[model samples]
Target: EFARAPGTSDYAHNTFVDFGGVTAKNVRLTANSNWGGMFNQYGLSEVRFFSIPVFAREPSPDSGTTDVDVDVTLSFRAGREAAKHDVYLSTDEQAVIDGTADVTTVTEASHGPLPLDLGTTYYWKINEVNEVETTTTWQGDIWNFTTHEYFVVDDFEDYNDYPPDEIWSTWIDGYGILTNGATVGYPAPDWNQDEHYVETAIVHGGEQAMPFFYDNTGSAAYSEGERTFAVPQDWTKHGIKALTLYFHGDPNNAAEQMYVKLNGSKVTYDGDAANLTQTAWQPWNIDLVGFTGVNLSNVTELSIGLERIGAAGGKGVVYFDDIRLYPLFSAVVGTFSIHPWTGDGDSGISSSKTYTHTGKFTGEGTDGEPFFAGNGVYFERDTNRSGTSWTLTGAANVFGTTNPVTVADDSAALARSFFYGDEDNNHPVLTLMGLLPNTEYVTTFYTVGFGGAGLRFVDITPGDNLGYPTRVDQNGVGSGSGQLIKHTYTATSTEMSFMFDALKTGDSWHHYAFSNEAVSPNLGSN
Candidate 1:
């Protein structure tokens, strides 16, 4: 049933009608009477209906997204007639759905960059509200997102050159103490009061890094920079397993054992000794489980220090940044190397190299079996080249400098044989399996060139981080020994890989043996 207007016109005109607050699913219309001017009884064309919009739609992060930042703003499209929005967020899904969850009513369509915890899934919803409308509330659908597992303990980004905010002011170093060898910042050339002390050029992830200088040349045995928390920090949250920090060293830095102290418990570095000399930024992931005698839940202090490894003390500058806490990653957090070795047979061992070899004589010497006398990590011979290139399947032994070297038994079998391939068609790849993600490893490779074969260049590229394409040059004058090349990388996946490309046409590549070892925060096994 409906009402009709009395007036009539040549063109079609719209009619207005009020239902006075009625709720129905269907509506019908019929002709009560016809105007006198019309030829027939009555006529009807079409009819349409409209109402106020209810629910909030279109979530910003959508839903079920993982690895979201802890400080993420929840936004959505508000209902058409909604004058205000009620935001509800929580870790419990049932709470958000029941309307009893924590609610924040706002005029805007967006909620927050909410205060959230790491490694957690949060459920959220919005209830659109308009008090004047007959239907005052419209409940929204439940949405959820997960935050990242890791949290930043310190990035050094908050520190500045100003007073109180200065990096050295917070990170107390041995600048004024004689017993400690650490000087946190650089000395300004002029008496400029507002001089920048933190290292700006060589940084790990941010605009600045702490330039901790160590001078153990005098009476000091070690250098350290410590920071005391204003309030006790609880490291036992978010299922955290490791504490990771990035350190960049100068080439002139003295080789010292880097260590971090939790509260007062010390955990010395287990990586290569030469890492302090390499100019690249290296990650030192310390396992929290290893910090014995410290209350992880109530962490009060943290210290980064370098201790003297030998009788003689050395000194240099090392930059530190991005000290963070990390949980075990399901799918590798960073890149890592698989191979590890003991001795450096070559020189110029970068932070990448765990060990290098300098010998020239090959597995076979001038005679049938010459004396193989050198302290090195030896690999078992792989009779088949194809199998060895794909998988290093042989027993490896690490020999210290003090260990006695045998002539025929040890040196003759020292892994000098490798897969020979054409540069254009075939390239060798070495793969190491069963590696742990978020762990750091050191890989070493032994390569040698034939006599008078000119300077052969080969591109050594790791599958993941540490760096890509480390170029190795082999001078083929006549040395029987091979050069040891090593690389350091964190494992981003369960497997580690390497690709060898011989840049020269005629020159070939030979690998006798290799080794792998986990350095920082060693879990005993990979």
Candidate 2:
């Protein structure tokens, strides 16, 4: 006899059978269950028979493999009423183990008593059986996992102090207004002195006030000096990469000049000294690489001279600030290319150009167009054309607008001919007169509405028989509705000529040219 019924539980629907009614000799019972019902109910029925078979337990994995060390552990329970079972573990493939063992066992449902090897993969399984000596064959799924080395970083730190090491100071004197007293020289007193130089905030001639020493004897008499601090021998031994000098100049006097010497070697002011003024403290960084001729490895001293190169009558003063020496470190300098004829024959213009390229610029309108125009020339990037090019459009008309355009008061203007443009007929043109002959040059144009624009060269020479006889034509249509057309001509002679034939005009085309270089008496000047 056999009976089937559902287990008395709400959480699970399990089927069980009662065989107590079977009263037969040598009786045996067998049961089978399967999933059933919408909610996963189960069915089970019992069968009574004689001669139940006995079986041996599956071999357990060696205990050594069962409790291996691992970076992390994982485990899971077989079922709510499931009894403790033996778990077996083995390596990937039945590969022969060389001194390394391959078997392991887990007594219960706990994971890892992992293997001892790091980053080794292994397979595992569990076997279920009855308390009696009867058991079923290995009936568990196989799983594999690998171990990995892991670590954590703790307590990391970095530190930096600006203007590292060697220190120097600047001071202004002869104002009779010395805060520390009547110091003899501008920036008077060496680093050991009681007083050092300070920059004046007042600006002169649109420039900063500078460090100065004055002598109001009513005669051309004034003396100013700058002192450098002592540097360690090891500093030069390791190589000094840079020197920062802080100084102030009379903003009103552009002709003032100052000389610097490090360890008695003249320090070239790579930039304009006349342009230095005392509006705020200024840092002048000098690259010591150029002074290769000087043995900086043994450098021990530094000095500066306040010489008045302007009208000797101007009794202006200069100021100085923080002076320092910085050790050389790996420094990356950005690279840029500039045409030779881009600036005046003075170093100031070149320095200004370099600064403009490397410094951040901000103005009104998108795409670098300045809202107002006062002194600055706008630099524009041309996207409609190929090749690395730029254009500078003048701000004349832009300045004439109801909302006049204005650049910063302290800024200087750099005008060029090649200005970037869109489909609109709004590009700029160059306005120079004579250009060097047969030389390749880049021309930048500036206009009021447009901004910075540039043009590269194939060849440049004097225009036809006209004063400026050579002409180069740039032809292309902008991405917009209009075309970009222009002809640049260079004058061969000093006389200026505006030949109407030299001008090309059309609804979709236009041309103009000019030379800005002075005609040189020497033919070799070209």
The best candidate in terms of lDDT: 1
Give, for candidate 1, the lowest lDDT window spanning 10 residues: 393-402
Compared with the true structure, what per-residue lDDT tens digits does model 1 show for residues 76-120?
988988999999998889999998899999999888767667778
| Candidate 2: segments with Cα more than 4 A from true spot | 1-197, 200-210, 214-222, 228-233, 246-249, 268-273, 277-300, 308-314, 319-322, 326-388, 391-526
Top candidate on TM-score is 1
Which regions in candidate 1 have their CA more than 4 angstroms from the true location? 1-49, 57-115, 119-123, 126-139, 142-150, 160-162, 190-195, 237-241, 327-526
The per-model lDDT (C-alpha) reads 0.65, 0.33
Give, for candidate 2, the lowest lDDT window spanning 10 residues.
151-160
1-526, model 2: which lDDT tens digit per residue? 2233555554343334455544334644453443342454444444334433221123233222433345235454442223455555556433222213343344555655443344356665555444533233334555555443211010001111123311222322334432221232333435465332222222211222233454323443434443443542333422245665544444454444455666566655544554353322234556666554677656555555544454442345555443445433222111111111212331122212211111112222354333221223223322222111222232122111222222223221322122222223333332233344443332221212121111211111212321111111121111111111122223333322222211222211122111122223333321
Q: Compared to the true structure, candidate 2 yields what TM-score?
A: 0.29
